[model samples]
Target: MRTLTERRLRLVGVAAQRAHDRLGRYPASAEQILVDYQGTTRSLIAESLVDAWGNPVQLKAGTSFDALSLGADGAPGGEANNADILLSELLASSAPRPRSPEFAGLQRDLADALHLQFQLDGIDYSHAHWRNSDLSVEQIQAALAGKPIPPKRHGPENHGTEPGADVSRADRTDTEKAADALFGALSGDSMLAKAMGFMMKMLGASSQARAMIKIVLADTLVHADAILQAQPAPLAELMKVLTVDRNTQVIHDLRAIIADEPETRSVAVFYGAGHFFDLEKRICSELGYRHESTLWVPAITIDINETGMTAAQLKGFRALMRRTIEQQLKQLD
Candidate 1:
């Protein structure tokens, strides 16, 4: 119920804002925001003025307009789900949505690197990137204050607490599901998997072989990492869509919240580790933030013996993968 109301508020409010801009005055009512307002097809209809609870949205016209949804109770004041929702507040909260320059540069650089790497390694680097997930300002503050982080809606369609934002996320989620299915089907026979399998065998081998292969494999894996940094699988293009592209909005929202709350002394952004590199650069370069400290947490752990490879073979196989990956990286370089 609140979800539908929020969407209408944003979409209808945006149309109303456009109408206001052209006429230099607020619309007399919600219905005055037309489908073709300012040559944009917002698809708004008479129903756009109707709130989720079947109450008409209250529109007060002035130099600046105020729109209101009377909540589930359809009354002036209430609490919880029945609380009043103000359109001005909603728009103000999300007003700082323009993409920052640093975000744009980082995205371009990553895409270029991925394209070049794919040409050489025939591997997708897209999965190497950070995945996008929402963490609200209130959640971060709660964590900082030693309180429990608030629970958020979880699943494919609920990318954000606000219903308006979920529209874009839904499209992204669909792409991600398809990409994941494709990635799973190809991973078994993929060169990366074979190389990893071989490496596991090397890890189980004798110390002498381990020592030699470790040095060589280390050098090779470094190069392989470079290749992984450069390319992403075509189907996994959704990885970039989910990780890099969606990050722009997240960063924009964070910046807005920060700006809106001038008294805030500290803010902690929580995201996948892969995202931090670019995010740090953006915050420092664009938002006038400085580096403070670092905390590392292990996200995953793997045991080599579980792969069912004997020691000697595992050592040799790792060396082979390392060398092959190194050569590929060198070619790209």
Candidate 2:
């Protein structure tokens, strides 16, 4: 049973797949085919096929994406489009996807940075980042005002609060008080990432999901203290309680990034693993992946107990993550 969100995400995957499949049968690059179909410039095609939010879709096209992007506006322009993230066409592919040498150096640079980040010592290396999960502005404000945070799509840790509850941390978890006991107490990087993923899945994400992704990506370089310093007030204290310091900064940033760019309009977010049982269709519409030659966008499931995290399990976790990324890349492809 696919939720509306999953169905929507399938739109992007379907569109991409249609374009990809056409290439094998009819010919022409994915961009060319789409341009012909939409009768628009490659740059503007994404904006033509609007999502449920009624916003035009904007894609950062490539064959095998290092990362598939929908930009901040979820339309065409904004921080994401301008960010140094997706600078050029991702030409690498098993299928024909606009191969060009100009993007080669850019690809190498990104790959190198990504590889380094993956190898960085004491990098936490878990899928979980230091990003602060987004609390709906209304929900947080209500909680601050001593009102109920909205019932959010939260997990058991949250005890089923309103979607985007504007509230303080609930007395859930394994503790009577969340004094930073740390997740996966007796775990490694893979387990930690999975734990974080589990936490997120139990909670549905915000449209600011893109913002959250940004924070996770930031872990590649940006300092945690730096991000906290950037934010103001009690929010900082709240972030601290979440244990999103430099050690877990990336994850926190990703969540914060969502609310950071709200003016951009509707956006969809995807966690690394299948966590949600029911997410909206609007989000799934703009972004997605492919499976068994059929395109689909289902809630990603995180691995709570991943193998190869410890010294004895390194090889296994590495392979697991690689397979996940590889699958993601193909979806974006």
Candidate 2 lDDT, tens digit per residue, 20-114?
55454421233543543422233333443443344433344455312233443444444523322221232222233333333133222222333
Question: Can you tell me which runs of candidate 1 are displaced by over 4 Å?
Answer: 1-225, 232-239, 299-319, 330-333
Candidates' TM-scores?
0.33, 0.23
Q: Find the number of clashing residue pairs for candidate 1.
A: 13
Query: What is model 1's C-alpha RMSD?
Result: 24.6
lDDT of 1 by residue, 61-136 (tens): 8887777999999999899879998888886775433333322222222223222111213223245333335645
- Point out the worst 10-residue segment of candidate 1 by lDDT: 111-120
* Candidate RMSDs in order: 24.6, 19.0
> How many clashing residue pairs, candidate 2?
48
By lDDT, who's the top model here? 1
Residue 175, model 1, lDDT: 43
- Superposed model 2: Cα runs more than 4 Å off: 1-182, 185-265, 270-276, 281-333
